[model samples]
Target: MLAIDFQHVTKRFPGVVALNDVSFNVRKGEFHSICGENGAGKSTLMKILSGVLTDYEGDFFVNGTKTGFTGTRDAESVGISIIHQELNLVEELSVAANIFLGRELRHSFFLNEAAMFAESQTLFDQLECEIHPRQNVSELRVGDQQLVEIAKALSLKSDILIMDEPTSALTETEVERLFRVIEMLRNEGVTILYISHKMEEVFRLSDRITILRDGQHVKTLNREETTPQEVTHLMVGREIELIRLGKGRQATEPVLEVSNLSLLWPGHARGWKLKDVSFTLRKGEVVGIAGLMGAGRTELLECIFGASEDLPEGRILLNGEVVNFRHPSEAKEAGIAMVTEDRKRLGLFQQMSVRENITICTLPDSVSTGIVHSRTEAAAAKKSIDELGVKTATAETAITSLSGGNQQKCIIARWLRTQPEVLLLDDPTRGVDVGAKAELYQVIDNLCKDGLAIIVTSSELPELITLCDRILVLCEGHLTGELAKKDFSEERIMELATKLAD
Candidate 1:
């Protein structure tokens, strides 16, 4: 019998039809994957099934019986649980408390703290990770927090599980461990509904794959009968060519240089967050930083951009002039701009308009006689929107109205308006789709051709191999190895990324 059945499911929002007549069925004890581009109704469909959106028009069946869930609690009451893409854990609570929240063990009307901690530890052991249950959720890194979420979902002991981009923040070792746990669960008859933008994960774990685009169902095919290329084509309705930017163009003289850079970690045993890191970036070159999670990739970028809270003991040079920037504004004035890793949390102004988001960085250029000129700001925004190919109904529209890919493009546009000689990007394509990723690659290539020096970091090794002229590998706050374009390989990069610091 089918474990899940959706008949004529349709969902509509204030200005969008999120899903239209979507129908699919998952056989019991099977791993089903749903693949689609950003803003393709994949999340909406899952939300409806998981009871986050109860007003949708649809008929759902669980194990041959008709079911309609009023909320997530109702879904959880009947063996359904989901791990959201954006984490839903309370920051102030301990890991154990967050895991067993609202369902804590009780003994004689008192909370059973010992039992909950022991159970949380068991779940962590099952996943083959070491995380103390008493640690505050906010104290852990993003990757570790992601593992906690996985453990919480496992704690439910649900028969049907929904995982939405569960591995987006995980490291290679963590992902491998997760796959082992998934396999064990499948063996125990737990059906999984997986959603992800990574084609590799989708192809690796799926028994059947469903494609959705623009609020409509496309097709469902057995995994053995499909290819990643075919599935990507269905997702975006086009062929996406891999980007290769390190062609015949030669790099010019050094535009930015760092020497003997080190950041001290206060109140920690390993005193440095970055250790004696040194590199030279030339104009018309894209240098990629390759590292595993907690290897200090983002911290390195933050140090260079003057956004790090702890000052580093280092020397930075811009065009042969020694400079020290105590703040990001100083770094910006010195022709350096950065796009942070978490766009939604750190980069974007969620409540602002697209035009305002793009033009806020350069308001001085759009002011006349101590007054902001609306026409000047709009003109500049229009130029960036055109150059970056940002898809929006109008420049005055809220930035949140756009898709993830387009919202990212807007952030890049904001930095481009500064006309910096050096650009720092932290995981620029984290949650973007294939089509938007290709577009972003093109944009980066064009910027390099125009003599802009760029430093980029990504968790995906293939992305660095394809786009960078050189790759620097960091492991545990130290520079482990550096590979030229000619020496690029996933194996070599991984070796360096996992090597111990000397």
Candidate 2:
């Protein structure tokens, strides 16, 4: 059965044509995906399908019934539900309340709290998820909250589910759980429309793929018949920068030494986020941490930044002197800076102007007589923007107005305020365009030339090969092995990644 059909659909934003006469069809019970770059109209098309955007320019059909969805409720009325890249949960509500918010069980013309909890609990059990329906939504981890979103969408009894970048924030275990749920939905005759930039996950999850470029339709292919390289070419329209094992080598002394670092998850039952992970970083060198999702790459950086917790066991040493940080401020004071994995959520305050966001972190350096020197701040902002080559009408523009790449450059500017001796970055180029990614590589290289020890975590193995002096492989919270620059290759990293317990 055909679940959805969009014929010559077009979406437009101010000064940008988001989707240009896009058309595609989705089959019932099949896992279908849309692939594109960040600004390629993938999100805009999903919004149109979910009825978040209504002023589109073409035909819309659901389940072979020609109709136009005016709003989200109308889309839902036709057995359709959507989970956005950034979830839309009410943080104050309980898990049960978020799931059955609009359609609640009533008692004598009043609310029925007990009935809601009971019903939500039943759904959780049916899905084999361990989330508590009574728990506040704010308390759940990102992975668990994503599961809650999926469960909530399923609770609507919808035959078609639209998921946008669902695995972008998920750990490997959480992704497996989601894959299981998706399989169950497919088996029960539900259609899925997935949107993502991560080609690996898309290939792993989708039955067929529909490629979109600049809001126009590209091509659709069977999952088995297509290859990642071929899919990547179709999405980007060219061969991307593969892992570059640099010709130059750095042999400087150790600038950052992490000894037996370990931190607790506090919520998980079995183990900690990092299990005694130890590594060394040297000035003029870049060390890359390679792992699957949830292999503790982000957690390791968080521990180093003092953003999560104190290293109860491990000691971080700069210039061979033991340093401990109980908070992010202390870490920043110690000349240690970390760029978070999720740039939108953790890195930037979208409402703030680019100038303010860039210079906010460097006030101490840009202050005069205890008051901020606006001139110095502006100069610093301009300098970084010019050096980073970020595209914007003006530095006074809102951070949200720029594309994903430019927004990332702004975050990079914020960190540059603290002239750090060591820099830790997590997936720095996840959503940026190719041109921006190249610019960031140059920025990183310049920093390395300035003798700053750098450590970064990335799932793109090709990136690791190109960007690092060495690559460390982590598997299930264990540091499996290290690959020197000369020995760095995708095949070797894959070997260490999959090497399990004897």
Candidate 3:
């Protein structure tokens, strides 16, 4: 039986056709995986099915009944529940409150707080997670918050669940727990529609996979009959060459050095977030920071960029001179640039145009007598767009209108205009697609060859191995190991990442 049947679907945004004549079907009680690059209409089609979008040219049937959903409640009424990629929980509320936000339990005219809490606890128990029902959502870690999302979906008793990059923020242990929950749901005859970029998870769980590209349906293949390589090729509509980094360059003069860097963490079991961490980057060198979540990889980069909340107790030397940067502006002024990990929150100005975002940092170069030169700014943005291969209709388009990969390219181009001596990238390819990742890797390699020093942090050890000349592993606020490119291995990095310092 077909749980979902979408035929001749077409969705258009203001300046782009998001979905173009896409048609697909999902069997009831089966695990279906959706594969696509960024802006490939995978999410768009799902959004239409879930009623996040209502005005689209298509015919959609749910459980053999043709339906036109007006809103999320309409979809939910028909046993459709979607867990968005960006978390939608209210941080100020308790976990129980977030779970029953719109569908609160009531006792005659009063709210049934105790009943809701009990139900939430039962949901958490089912997921095998330890999140307290009464705990504030803000106090919980990201992985726990993701579990709460799952629990919320489970609470709805929806037979059809759509998970959009549900494990993007989860830890390895949390992922295992989630997979077990999925298995339980499958046993209960629930249908699952999962969207993810990770090939391993998709292949392991999906009974069938559907590939989409450029807002169109490409192919649907049974898991047993297809391979990851074939799916990737279909999604991109071309064979993606493996990322091959150039030969490592000889280390020249030191560009940046840090000694005994430490940041105090108050009211925690650990007294410090980083303890006496030190490293050095020479000209034309790329150093990778490898660590698990909370291993201080991001903190290390924040300290170097002068963006950390707590002042670090240590010394930083740039170009053989002691430099103390109180703010990120100071670091930028001193020939250092950083691309942050959280792109939505930290990197792009969502309200601004692509041209403005590209030239915001280097506006001075496009200004004369306190008047901003529009033509010069546009030219500079255009140049960066072309150089970075940003696929955008125009420089004046809104930054948020672009795909994840293009928005990232604009951010990278923004920093490159500064022409810094050192660049800091914290998981530059966190949510980017495979094709864009290859392009970004080549861009990074080209920059390194041009004598730019860089320090990068990534959750994927394979990514680090492919890009870095040396990898520095951190565990519990301490530098546990450093491996040369020849010595790089995922097992070695994981060992050092989990090791505790005495």
Find the candidate with the highest TM-score and give its number.
1
In model 2, pairs of residues that clash are: 244-466
Q: Give lDDT: candidate 2, residue 138.
A: 80
lDDT of 2 by residue, 1-502 (tens): 7888889998766556778988889887899988876667787888888888889899878889987878999999988889876567888999999999888889999989999999889877766667899999887655567778878888888888999877665645456677887888888888999987767778888889999876789999999999888887888787777534344546589988888887776767756777778888999888999886657777788877887744556788888888777788888888888888767667889789889888888877888788888888889999988988776667887887566667888888789778998898988876665546766887887788778888988767777787898898887677889898789888888788777423
**Candidate No. with top lDDT:** 1
lDDT of 3 by residue, 311-381 (tens): 99999999999987889999999999999876766798989999999999999999999999999999999
Instruction: Please report, as a residue range, the 10-residue window in candidate 1 with the lowest summed lDDT.
Output: 241-250
lDDT of model number 2: 0.80
**After superposition, which runs of candidate 2 have C-alpha atoms over 4 Å from their true positions?**
27-29, 55-59, 64-66, 105-130, 204-208, 219-227, 262-277, 289-297, 309-314, 363-397, 401-406, 429-450, 458-502
Estimated TM-score for each candidate: 0.93, 0.80, 0.93
Give the lDDT of residue 345 in candidate 3.
Answer: 62
Model 3 residue 1 distance off true place after TM-score fit, in angstroms:
0.7
Ranking by TM-score: 1, 3, 2
Give the runs in model 3 whose Cα sits over 4 Å from its true position. 91-96, 105-151
Q: Ten-residue segment with the worst summed lDDT in candidate 2?
A: 242-251
Error of 2 at 223 (Å): 5.4
